[model samples]
Target: MHNILSVSELSKTYDSRFQALKRINLDIRRGEIFALLGPNGAGKTTLISIICGIVKASEGSVRVDGHDIVADYRAARAMIGLVPQELTTDAFESVWATVSFSRGLFGKPANPAYIEKILRELSLWNKKDSKIITLSGGMKRRLLIAKALSHEPEILFLDEPTAGVDVNLRRDMWQLVRSLQATGVTIILTTHYIDEAEEMADRIGVISKGEIILVDEKAELMRKLGKKQMTLQLQTTLERIPPALAAYQLELASDGNELIYTFDAQGERTGIVALLKELNDADIVFKDLHTTQSSLEDIFVSLVKEEK
Candidate 1:
């Protein structure tokens, strides 16, 4: 796959001696939704800001579609569109007017048809004549996205696109993102929502303390670090684990009615046969057994904690 955006040895340092970003290197594949995951102040915004030319990097470089952000800033910026976390729009401007004006800002010729399509896609067509202030909070967020797409950018960067939005609007925005992906628009988003990353991202990138800690396909990441738990419903209560089962990592749960055995999914063997044999020897009877895999949220939390 071809990469639309590339960052090499990117670093950012503020005057206050704060290092916002370390030696970061990343490549965003063409037409893939890449999610950057991190806690607050983890340089998610700073990385996007540098790529979009909103904030200058202290070191290293960024290239958008083969155009260096610094040397060929115009060409690079023209290939990208950014929907900021903040909602800053003209209060009195009509929806149509605001969207149309955004297109002109990118040196794009006026295209009423294109503007209309975006509004209709975002379900903002009915409010075309309504002033921005008259619209709801959700509408304002949608309008920001409209303005970002008004210029028909090839690569769209969404910064916490669903933050502070309601459930319905969040679902709507996710649908909108999928629609854009269908049109071959590359999307890179930074979000605190782990499930959003799990559901939408083609690849996940984890950053912490000004460093790029990990990046991999969502499924692969899960498999490599994922653990599974097998829960057994005991037929009778037991005072403690037998010495024969002490070799295995197990926990008693459900008030001693359940026994939980945890093992790595990526391991060569789950040791179920050994555990069953040992249980039989100990006269332990399980009426039911069920298994569960670790979720993305669990993996994310563990990674962050390990990094910290």
Candidate 2:
């Protein structure tokens, strides 16, 4: 797929002389779910804001479908929709009125049928006449989404979209997101929930300390950085691992009744067979063995920790 959004040499600095983003370059493929992962104060929000035209960049350029964000601000911003982290809305305005107003803001002609479709999809049809202040947190979250989709934007930015919502809302939001993508809407989300990104993202971009640390296809990333651990339940307890097993770098656990071996699953050879044979030679028998691969969360935490 071709890139729908391009960010080149992006950098952001506040008046206090603090830099939030370094010279960054990124391309977001059209109609793909791209997840931007980073720790707090890691420039995820700064980058999103710049793209959405909410904040000015210190030095760089952004383009939406080849429309320069600065030179073609109207066209670039028109194609994008942003669901902000804050739950800001007109308290006294009815849901339908607020969503309809959003569409008008983008110079879109009145389309009641389209408005009703989104309301029903969001399960807000029954509450369409209710005031925003009367809605619960989850309902309010859904309203924010409805407004973002009001203009039928080609690109959507969900910043911590499911942060404080319930399980049901989270599930519903993802379902809606999928449907939107099916209709050719490109998705870019910044989320604290690693599991969400792991399950949904087509590609993952990790940023750290104002720098783009890594960006890769999700499956390729997991294969390259992911580790696997094999745990062996010993037949007998021991005070320490045998000298002969030192090369394997096994860790003794469960009061020396278990041995943990870490290896790269993608490696040419994992050394599992050699380790098992060596264990037999040392008379260290295992009653049971199981293995687990590191999750995206594990890789994300380790990556951020390394930056620190």
Candidate 3:
């Protein structure tokens, strides 16, 4: 549970007086997958850039593994690797050369074994001699990850890693992420795909209007804020709801052939028994009933909307 990275009172303001981040304070735990979720213009990129030493914070400080990003820039930057949102790479460079070169940029001595290991792990071994431009989009994306891992960084930042990838590739990337975690790499990702975060992260952080809003364990966050809905397929279609069922605030759907009741998942009582009893008294029988809980995307949308 030790912190591998820390940001304190971080803020960013551009020349036009646009404050990109507002007193943001965050701690990334060692060997944990932390997902940072936010709407566009919410400082997700700005914060990552600052941590990667690409952009300077207007005020405050960041430390990577006890090394201040500003004062001990080399050490701080060396421990972190960033896979940016955009696919920026030399089109003419071979996969092996590009990855090897990235490690050298960090002043890491040439470790061909390490480079080969990462390329193989990323499924880029077959394409090691392929020019960057010759690889498919998915292969290029994997190459970015290979380059990031070339220097054996303890922390990896994946910014919108699967943004435009197909479903199959996304799942492949998910598997890759889990394997990386098994190797004890701390992962901090900023993604627009909420399901990606829900599936991969140990904890979730929400930022809005350039400020950190909420951070919680994924399951706990969903449990606290998630709601459940029960949909009953009625045996008989009804024109309207009965007066006695007013308390349930149910919605008639499927042209009155279905009744949808939403209830708080965290409530002391869900009132299901009472609802069934009332349905029996009203002579309303349901053919079937199914319940669904809130999804991470639902909670994310609500949080962002609340901020707006």
Per-candidate local distance difference test: 0.92, 0.94, 0.93
TM-score, one value per model = 0.96, 0.96, 0.94
Off by over 4 Å in 3: 281-283
Error of 2 at 44 (Å): 1.2
State model 1's lDDT. Answer: 0.92
Question: Against the hidden true structure, what lDDT does model 2 obtain?
Answer: 0.94
Number of clashes recorded per candidate: 0, 0, 0
Report the lDDT tens digits of candidate 3 across residue range 78-118. 99999997778889999999999999999999999888888
lDDT of 2 by residue, 1-308 (tens): 89999999999999959999999999999999999999999999999999999999999999999999999999999999999988677799999999999999999999999999999999999999999999999989889899999999999999999998888888888888899899999999999999999988999999999999999999999999999989999999989988999998999995988999999865526599889889998988899999999999999999999999
Candidate 1: regions farther than 4 A off: none
Deviation in Å, model 2, residue 180 alpha carbon: 1.5
Would you list the rank order by lDDT, best first? Answer: 2, 3, 1
Clashing pairs in 1: none
lDDT of 2 at 97: 97
